[model samples]
Target: MDIQPTSGSAGQTGGFAAGGAPSSGGGLINSDFETFLMMLTAQMKHQDPLNPVDSTQFATQLATFSSVEQQVRTNELLTALGAQMGALSVSQLSGWVGMIARAEMPVHFDGQPVTISTRAADLADRAELVVRDESGTEIQRLPIDPGRQELDWAGVSDSGAPLPAGIYELSVDSYAVDELIASDGVFVHARIVEARNENGRPILVMESGQEVAAGDIVGLRQAQ
Candidate 1:
């Protein structure tokens, strides 16, 4: 359950350097703030009574320092909040493993049937399922009932033989007589094998090695 660094990340207070971020950084305003106070105290002590420091300018400088300090603290808070939310999201996604995730994307086939879900287009009288390989070459086309929303791709080619194990793209073409009307990618179902957080977003890794965003899931269901 450890989200040990999957990849490298810049330090937490990297961007806040120009603004004097106080968290995990050095030589910033917080450090400068102390140094500035000491300098100011010395200046006041050594100032000639005939030409004392101006009250108005001194107040303005203090106010500017106060504003910069507040800004740095705000950045620190935002970093903390982002971390908490990312952790919470990944923890929630842990339950998704062993469940089915339905999404619209290229599918990997390994000599097994892949379930494809489609949204039936009402305008077309005829529908055809088109399968393309990873190279974008059309490999198979089959007539399908226009009203059918789900089908299991048998991973077979036109030669009545099994297709090799690889990634394939699937889409449905809707035709109105001689005119092609709508073409939409179909949803391919895969099981979630692992879930991890990447830059505050949950990434679900499928059994096929495909990665899907947690928010991109079109449907979820228990595995049969």
Candidate 2:
């Protein structure tokens, strides 16, 4: 799979700073507001008696500093949010290893089935679910509900037999009002075989041997 490598991954191209840092290359050394205040105070104290520092110039400088400070604060907040999101994703995905996830797929359900959910296109008259094993053999096929909001699967065989309860991905193809839509289904029930740090971010390795970042998941649950 072609993936854009992030700094936390081993093969990533560049790195990212987790938190705030001084600007690279020679630039402003001190906080802009502090610098402005210091300069303004010096000017006031050393100004010619007849020509004091202009009020308009001081106000402009202060305003500039205020804007710069706000920008710095905003950048810091965004970085923190990103880190928090990554943590949440890892926690959520970790829960799905032994649980059943609802996603769209062509896999069939034989006995008591585990249900997965996926959105079908409005124009889809019929959708197909294709299930493949580790050897990449087509094991099952199921029709989809064109009108219903979601599709369900119990991870069964085409003959309605119970297959081994494990990770099975799905691929969807639907036609709605003569328009075609194709969607990819992921098995959220796989165990996290490994945790990899790429480009300063975390990637979860699924038991199915799929690699995905924490941000890729939408939901998690115990498999029935």
State which candidate has the highest TM-score. 1
Residue-wise C-alpha lDDT for candidate 1, range 1-224, written one tens digit per residue: 11122112222211112234233333475677776565556555554455555555455556666777777778878989998999899999899999999898898999989888875478889889999999999998998887758888999988889999999999989888757888988998899999998988989999889999999998889999
Using lDDT as the measure, the top candidate is: 1
Candidate 1: residue 191 Cα off by (Å): 1.1
Residues 35-72 of candidate 2 have per-residue lDDT tens digits of 45654566545555454445565555556556656676
| Model 2 ranges off by over 4 Å | 1-33, 45-52, 102-204, 212-224
lDDT of 2 at 56: 61
In the order shown, the candidates' Cα RMSDs to the true structure are 11.6, 15.0
Q: Roughly what TM-score does model 2 have, to 2 decimal places?
A: 0.44
TM-score of each: 0.79, 0.44
